[model samples]
Target: MQNNKRRLVRHELNASIDVWDAQSDEHLGRLANIHAQGLMLLSDAPLVEERLYSLRLTLPQSLVGAGELTLAVDCLWVKSSEDESRHWAGCHIIDISDQGLAVVELLISRLR
Candidate 1:
C-alpha cells in the first residue's frame, strides 16, 4: 500500500544552495524549503524535469552546526512561478548520509 502520510516534517528555509547537474556539473540554482523527503528549488534557468542533480546546501551554522549537506536529488517536477522570474522545481532526496540526516533533524526540531 502507498503511504499517504508525511514521513518527515518539512522545514521552511529560503536557504541558498550550490546545485549542479550530476553528470555535466552545470550549475542549477538555489534551494528553497527543504525536508528529509523533498525540497523546492528556485532557478533562473529551468531544470529538466525528472533528472537527478547533485546539491551542496549549507545550512546556517546555527541550524546545522557547520559544513555543507551534500546529496543527490531527483527532480520530480517544475513550474514557473507567477512572476516568471524563476522556475520552482520539486525534488526528492535520493541519497544522504546518516550524519546529514541527523543535522537535518536538528534543524527541523529547532524550526518547530
Candidate 2:
C-alpha cells in the first residue's frame, strides 16, 4: 500500500499566474495549484528534473493583491499529460520572503 505523506493540504486551483525564472528572469510557464510548501506548474515543455529554480509567481490582482511572490523551488518531478500538449511539473519551495509568506497565507486562508 502507498502512504499519503503530504505535509500540507493542497488546494486544487484553476487560477492562472505567470511564472518566471528568478535568476535569468525568463518566463517559464503558468501556475496551476498552490500550497504552503509547493506548487504545480503547467508548461509547454518539461523542466529539468532535480533542478533548483528561483521562481517569481505573479499573482492575480484579484487573488493576491496585485504583486509577484518570490520563491526558491526545487523541481521534484515532470510528466506529460494525457493530452500531450503540455507538461506538468511538481516543485518543492525552498524559500519565501516574509511579505510573500504573509500574502501566501492570506491566499491560502481565502482559498480554504
Candidate 3:
C-alpha cells in the first residue's frame, strides 16, 4: 500500500463541509470529498492541467463558522471519463495552515 498523505482518513457526509468559489473563480466543479492531503472536486468548467489554485472550504455548520480557509494546492490529476459530463479534479494541498489541519482532523474524527 502507498500512503501519500501524512495521515489520511475518510470523512463521512456528516463531517463534510461545503466548499465554494471564493472569488467566484471558474472551477470544474464543487468539492466532492476530502482527505488529509487533499480533496476531489467535480466541475463542469475546464481547467488547465497541473495548475495551482486557491480554495476555501467553508465550515458553515461546524464551530469553525462560515469563514474561508485558504488552501494552496496543485492538481494531482483529473478524471473526465465518468458517465457524468462534469470532470473531477484530484488535488494535493501544498500548504495547510495549523487551523486547516485541525479542521481536517476534526472532520476525520467525526467519521470514526
Candidate 4:
C-alpha cells in the first residue's frame, strides 16, 4: 500500500547536491528545493528510470553545517513540468537514520 497520509508538511530550501548518473557515471546538474524527501532537483536531465542511486544532499542551514546524509534512492518516475523547462523526478529514499529523521522533524517544525 502507498503511504496515503502524504504528510502535507513540505518545505522549500536551497541546498547543494552531488548526483552521479548511474548509466554514464557522469556528474549531473546541481540545484535545490525545499523537500522533506531531501531535495527536488531541477533539471531536464534524464535519469535511468526505476534505477537506484546514491545521493549526497546537504541539509538546510538549521542543521548547521556542510555535512550531508547519503540517501539510497530509487527514481519512481520522471516528468517534465508544464513549462517544459525542466524535469522533476519523484523519488523514494531508503534506509534513513534516526538522526536524519530528527533533522527532518526540525525542518517541519519551522514550517508550522
Task: Output the number of the TM-score-best candidate.
Answer: 2
Misplaced by over 4 Å in model 1 are 1-9, 14-27
TM-score of 4: 0.60
lDDT of model number 3: 0.67
Query: Which regions in candidate 2 have their CA more than 4 angstroms from the true location?
Result: 1-4, 63-66
Q: Let me know the TM-score candidate 3 reaches against the reference structure.
A: 0.71
Considering lDDT, which of the candidate structures 2 and 4 is the better prediction for this target?
Answer: 2
Task: Compute the lDDT of residue 19 as modeled in candidate 2.
Answer: 94
- For residues 9-37, write the lDDT of model 4, one tens digit per residue: 44554344555454455665453443456
> What are the models' TM-scores?
0.74, 0.84, 0.71, 0.60
Model 2 agreement with the true structure over 1-112: per-residue lDDT tens digits: 6365778877665566789998998888988777888888999888889999999888778776657888999998898889888999989889988888787777666654
Off by over 4 Å in 4: 1-9, 14-39, 60-62, 82-84
Model 2, residue 30: distance off in Å is 1.4
User: What's the C-alpha lDDT at position 81 in model 1?
Assistant: 77
- What is the per-residue lDDT of model 1 for residues 5-111, given as tens digits with 9 covering 90 to 100? 66766677544555566556666777676788887787898877888778776567666557667788888889897888889888888998989778667756675
Task: Give the candidate order by descending TM-score.
Answer: 2, 1, 3, 4
Q: Mind giving the per-residue lDDT tens digits that candidate 3 earns over 4-100? A: 5536654444544555555665333565777778877767764456988777776646456646577878887776755757777778888888888
